[model samples]
Target: MRATTTLFSLSLLLAVSARNTYRSVLTDCLNTASVPILLTSTTGWADEIEPYNLRFTPAPSVVAIPRTQAEVQSAVKCAHANKIRVSVKGGGHSYGAYGLSGTLVLDMAEFQTVNLDQTTKIATVGAGVRLGNMANKLFSLGKRGVPHGTCEGVGIGGHATLGGFGLDSRLWGLTVDTISSVTAVLANGTAVTASASQNKELFWALRGAGPGFAVVTSFKLKTFAAPAVNINWSYTYSFPTPAAAATAFQIAQTWGQQSAPKELGYGIMLFPGNAFIVRGVYYGAKAKYDALIAPLLAKLKTAHGGVEPTKSVKTLGWIDSLTDLAGAALATPARGYDAHDTFYAKSIVTAESAPLSFEALTALFTYLYTVVPPSSAQWMIIANLYGGPGSVINSLPASTDPSSTSSYAHRTAGYVFQLYAYTANSLPPFDADIIPLVEGMVTAMGEEAADLPAYAPYADPELGQAEAQVRYWGDGVARLKVIKAQVDPMGILYNPQGF
Candidate 1:
């Protein structure tokens, strides 16, 4: 009788708790400022709730789609005043369900818009705009940017805040470098604009550390004049000999260091099939580009011999080429991707580190093949050649908030090495099979890996907040902490990095 009574009371308590939770989330969501409330059974609710990686399911009682910065400001204010958990959503591309796990998710997908100033070459873009949309729209207006990630559907919010890299990066710079100003809603529900001249410290923090601080409503970026870009070649080589493949990679790196122009960006890839592929874009005229890349052509074996530059389309509009970089054709402009981006990466290969380069890299690649089978899909590595016209990243002041660190510091100058883990299927094999290989490789690299810094946007959350601080803020973590205390003293924001 005593056990039965206790069981009955527990059941009753659970029922009441669930009811309260649902009611609280619903009430707070409905009261959000200038936003539309989304309920469980609403049409398209399921679609809106899906995240970029399709890894986790959201458990929000309600989703609030805000259409303007004012709405974002209002939503933040309401959540704080009502003591409800708030999460901001832009493109739903974040892994680990960061945006959609709260009592109320502020969906900014409806806030997609791009307003460009042709005269000044500046773009004030909506927080929710996807890279594909922004790039395509900008192309139509005869301009382009540093190009976004290869994946089409990546949201600007996650991409920009994490330090974006793309084809034009060698010539221009990372996406964050071009940012002019930002409009964000703070923890206390106050709306503020941050830039170089005003709230300078806050502006610095927002560059790479922004997402953890506030909900970005909009951004003003310094845009560049669009020009025709020449994509010279795409070649794939499968090597039977691992040593030969590593030699080719080393040669390519050497050539890239010596001959590749700033206007040209080359990328290297090590495939699951033991193939080493090299692809690149030429930012200058075709004739000069061909001449500059002669060394790469010479290095290829007779069996792998040839250069295939697009003949009819020798030169492509800046935006169009960005699409082409995604392997999209001119006719089918709608090609897109749903992507989850994180860089489990280490340093670049330079002379000082060349002694261990061959062993370290080959071991890493061989391990990848063993863990992630060739049949496994959804990933690639992007080894970008940095140091060119826009190669001033290393020149920034050491105290600059988002200063570039030495993960890819192997370049006598520097470069960016990224590991792309692409898995179309969510199965036991990936977490069990693939992730361990990655972790093990990083471990094998040991002190060499520790010397490398992770990209904020792409750092694995598994490392928890400590690793994030080292990756994004580096030595600037102290300054970020001061700002976090002043702006969000109560820590109302849900920082995965733990600030």
Candidate 2:
């Protein structure tokens, strides 16, 4: 018995020694590599490791900040050699912090560079560049623009790869639709450029399922001439009861179904104060804008039963229009990307075939006002109008849509429903209570919309792996899996819901 105990102790000691040796070897390799690595003991390690969402704080084995493509290659090689997992972080805007984990983190903050070619109107942007900065840069240089998200802090790498939707998506299509080419490093530390004609399969996967396959360094995106003038319009109506709110929602739903002009973008925001607001933007003269919105205003007035919206409209330059849309949130450093806040967000794409039911809409608003805590940092329901008739995105055939080759499978959706719950403090029962409510809201939406799938870019970890796969990829899952196996046979790049 004593001899057996001694043998067991010796085996445990050998295992510990082996682990220590492995860690030491990896640390030494990273330290002596072509690029500098930030160890846990380093001075700026905390800042580099901090993600946009404070909810997820992972202690990675090492944080690597690469300044160039070669450095990125070096970092990947070192991690691969040591058999350590790797997660790539661009703008760090993932609400669930998928950009971070207990593995090695490749911080791309230092690779932010945007260059534009006026002749071809092609902008080459680093993966680390944020949407707001990119838009501002394009406007200043050549009055150019790209279809991107409203939140300026979102990174191009994750956003474009996962079907980027934005205010002007109806006009120009998604950010991925503008991508002309990509330069990325593969799982084996080999860098390659992908386009429609070159590395065709990789190109298709990179358009949507990029994070799961490669570490993208830069993108060559096609740009368009910015509108000469942009007109912003807003209307807010206070509903005294759930019935009134339901009536307003019904009216808005009918109006949304109408075939509006391609230049017009519209949506509704249901705030915590039982306020239903209709907001839109027109990329043309006031005369045309007024003519287009006249029917909407009349219908809203009639259905609202004498409750009128406080209306406002303004005309501004392209840059100012973006600033107005983003509001004061633009002034925050990194566009509020580094704010320490905790939040839960889930999104679904609703098709015109299955609209939100009156019962579900009523229940949603009632629950929002009654059960949600008043002290919550932020809570709101946002519905963005997309895939409108005559929309460039809708005009494309299903086979030609961006979702065809990529994993983004919600091309037919007309509106995106987002449920958000935020809190600054970590109080007890926050997750236990709020998370289920959020899920319930999404579940209700799914029921009303015929079990439609959720958007991939939102990245809800609460949705188990199998459900997330179906919701994000749908029929494209099999193809994505095959490509993932071929490209990353060893499964190097990974995330909670990633391939």
Candidate 3:
């Protein structure tokens, strides 16, 4: 028995020795690497590893803030050499806080370059460039902009890859669809360009599910001409009960499926007390906006003796329109992010072919307003129109709609529902009821239609890996895994629900 015990002790000692050697070697390599590398023991590492979503506290062992392509390659190579997992932090706005996941963090805060070719109108944007900065720069350089999310702090790296959606996406297509090419460092530490023609498979994989593949350095985006005249419009309607609000939402779903024009981008923002606002931007004149919007308002009035909503509309230039949508959250800092939320946010994308039935909508809203959610915390729901008669988002792959054959699988997303539960402040003491209340809203609808899937961009960390895979990627899981194995076999580049 003593001999056996001695052998066991020896084994344990050897294992500890091996681990110490491994970590020491990695430390030597990263410390000598030609970039800023922060060890967990290093001063200010705590501040550096802070997550944008205060709810998630990912403990990365090492943080490498790469300023140049060479530096990125160096950091990636160091992690790969040490067989450590690497997660890239761009603008650090991951709802799931996946950017600070894994053992090593490649924070791309210094790669802030935005160059727009005036002739071709092609913009070369650094992966680290936040959406607001990119938009502001693009509009100033040439009256050009790429379709992106409302949060200016969101970096293009994950946002574009995870199906970047915005008000303009219905007409312009998603931010992923704007890519002409991407310069990324693969798992093996070689920097290469992935596009439709060059490294085609990689390009296809990167478009939709990029975080699973490589460290993208920069992107070449095919920018659209910024609208000379942009119109912003809003309408507020109140209902006696949540069920009544659901009736209005059902009317909205029908309108979104039947008549929503591509030139129009809108969302129905639901607030407490059964109050909701149908607000968005139109690409053209106010008269045209009113005309296009008249059908919905008329239909609403006809239903249950619904009264006309309080209306507000304004016309603005390109940049001001972005500011209006983004409000004051557009200024994203480079190094450490100051803005944060203790929140739970998730999304569901219903197919255009399967608009939410009235029964399903009622179950969702009624459950939200009456049964589950308490008055302790704040909550919001927005059903944004992504598809209808002529939306660019509905353009399938291999089609002539300029929607290239990429991994983005939500072409049929008719209405993308965003559900959020949060505190008024950035600090926690987050309501325990928040997640269940938010999740049940999706589950309520899914109970009506079991095949309904969640959106990949607004990733929910509560989901299991297998469940999230099916919900996020749907039919593309097998193919994505195949490509992920091809490029990132070591599985260094990873997130919780990533391929």
For this target, which candidate reaches the highest TM-score against the unseen true structure? 3
Cα lDDT for residue 277, model 1? Answer: 74
Top-scoring candidate (lDDT): 3
For lDDT, candidate 2 versus 3, the one ahead is 3
Backbone collision tally, model 2: 0
TM-score against truth, every candidate: 0.84, 0.91, 0.93
lDDT values for all models: 0.64, 0.77, 0.83
Which residues of candidate 3, in runs, are more than 4 Å off? 1-21, 304-306, 372-375, 398-404
Clash numbers, per candidate: 5, 0, 0
lDDT of 3 by residue, 1-499 (tens): 9999999999999997986676677668877876788887888887888877888788877788888898888888888898988898987888888999877888888889999997888999998899988998888898898999888889998898878998999899999998989999998889999988898888887888778688999999989999988998888888776678788888878887788788888888987666778888999987888788888889887664757778888899988898889986456677666778888988787887878888888787777667545446678888899888788888656221244557787877778888898876656867767888787777787565555678888888888898888888777778778888899898878777887
> For candidate 1, what is the lDDT?
0.64
Off by over 4 Å in 2: 1-21, 329-337, 374-377, 397-405, 424-431, 444-446
Candidate 2, residues 402-469: lDDT per residue as tens digits? 54544457667778888877663743234545676677666653466546678778888788877887
- TM-score, ranked from best to worst: 3, 2, 1
Q: Can you write out model 1's per-residue Cα lDDT over 15-81, one digit (the tens) per residue? A: 9798677556556656644467777778877777776555466777677877777777777776776
| Poorest lDDT segment (10 consecutive residues) of candidate 2 | 328-337
Per-residue error for 116 in candidate 1, Å, reads: 1.5
Flag regions of model 1 displaced more than 4 Å: 1-29, 32-34, 300-314, 328-356, 368-379, 388-392, 399-413, 424-431, 444-446
